[model samples]
Target: MTTAVDTRQVRDLAVAALAWVSAHRGDFALGADALTADGPVDLTWKPLGELAQTCVSVRRCTPPSDPLHACASDLLDFAWQQTGRGELFLRLQRTEPFATYPLEVYSVFAGAGLRHTGYEVAAGAVARSRGWRLTEHEPTRRLGLLNAERRSGIHRPERFAQALGRTWLGGLPEPWTFERTSGYALTHVVFHLTDWGRTAQDVPAELAAYLTDWLPPWLDTCLDAGMWDLACELLIVAASLPQPIDAATLQDPWRRIARVQHASGALPLMASDPARTHEADPEPSFVHGYHSTLMLAFAAALTQGVPV
Candidate 1:
């Protein structure tokens, strides 16, 4: 049976995590050389992508009344100013393996930022052309292309609908076996299906049912193994379902993660031995904690329906 989630506790944790991110924003910022008269540009795309997503997550999870709301908004503005105009700039210098990730990240962040904050940054004709070229040249990136379309309000419904018809949620490998790739792919699929949960009907009934049934066990397995990042992503999937998972089902993982969060507000990549921190960086590295903390904030925001 499901029980009640301690919402106050969840809010406190999110606020703390947001505070930690606010304090460390510079650590996540692009180098000084990346800034330009037009705005910040020439960013290191990967970290900027991560930071963008982090800003979106926090923004989605906090409310105007909440103190973190202003901070999230500021950080997002900072991120957009730094990288928004640079979409085409980064594309020009793109390298393999990292190529598609930055585009997808920028699209997700830009789209969600617009949705939540009414903040607009034009990707321009060059970026649009780049998206089409990437889509045509990289057939596997159909989802990313759709995301870019949806965010930019380009309205290619037929293409998105066609892609949805072919999606096979059950065909995905179990989280335990495929680990990182499988987990990330599933999260992306859900994000697209729900349009980041803006349209509940967009989530197909079959996919929603599959997640409703499987997510609990999958979440437990990841938590048991101390895969905090995957566990957090699973929580996001659970939050996005049409029939939302019971908050009680998420309570244990939430509390465990909260417990493991360092006083600095950064969560370790896994449940770590205290002795290990002494040997490495004194604080949990931002890279180590970013996704999990960001997702935790997202889960709290989505589950609670904090006003965008």
Candidate 2:
């Protein structure tokens, strides 16, 4: 018999597993957790080399009316699960959950009202992960399942690199991350996306306000290179977290991309510079950008309130 919580968890995990699979088609395959016409799928954050492998049935989980391989609810679940999974969510989203799922995943919903289902699942998943009852260190266990390529791993910046042609120039690369530079922006997004509960009030008004305005940069990564998917996700996350910034900030990322007037399709992907860090030692820089930014921004917003 399914308890209310158990029933909710299955539905929630169903969506989470779906989003996890789609967003990380490569990782899911590496982990061999991709859902096929088989039975139940077993998954871990790590790749199954030998002991990790498991036999399973495959099943195609899809809707007949929907041709899109992925769904919004699953993406939403993925975002929520990432947040719940803490750093995994940070690594996976590369921006923020709320920004990614509701804003971008709507295409999967096919214009249907996905409001209730998505919200319910997202809230449930996060509560489990971020709940006060759980210790802060709880998420580190996922680190155990991590693969060696954290440099080249899914956690590495630019795991989702896209190469496309530009109008005059022909071809260009759009990278997703910058070693030490993106920390402030990343943390601001993560802090806002978190459930600070009523305690956010304890964080001070000035610091809170900076988190609002300072986020515009993540939306404006580079003038020519752009990432609306990440921007929308940042926006969705901002809205879900109920930040001070308005939807106007969300428009900046898309606006920049739209205004570019590129003859070829815009190449929107993670930032990458092999010389810089995020890839060298995944441990030091993983969420360091966001973490440091949040702390510094809070201090500045509270005391100085300057970009520094």
| lDDT, each prediction | 0.60, 0.27
Model 2: per-residue Cα lDDT over 1-308, one tens digit each? 11211323223323332333343333333222222223122333322111111000001122334322235333334433332323322333333332222222222121122233343344234333434123232121112111111211123231111110111111211223432234323433232223111123332344445446544564455322333224433432333233434544433433342332112221123323323312212212212222211221122111111111
Q: How does model 1 fare in lDDT?
A: 0.60
Tens digits of per-residue lDDT, candidate 1, 167-222, equal: 44545445346455566667777777665655666777877777777788877766
Cα error, candidate 1, residue 236 (Å): 1.4
The per-residue C-alpha lDDT of model 1 at residue 39 equals 34
Cα deviation of 126 in candidate 2 (Å)?
Answer: 21
Candidate 2 lDDT? 0.27
TM-score computed on alpha carbons, candidate 1: 0.75
TM-score versus the correct structure, for each prediction: 0.75, 0.29
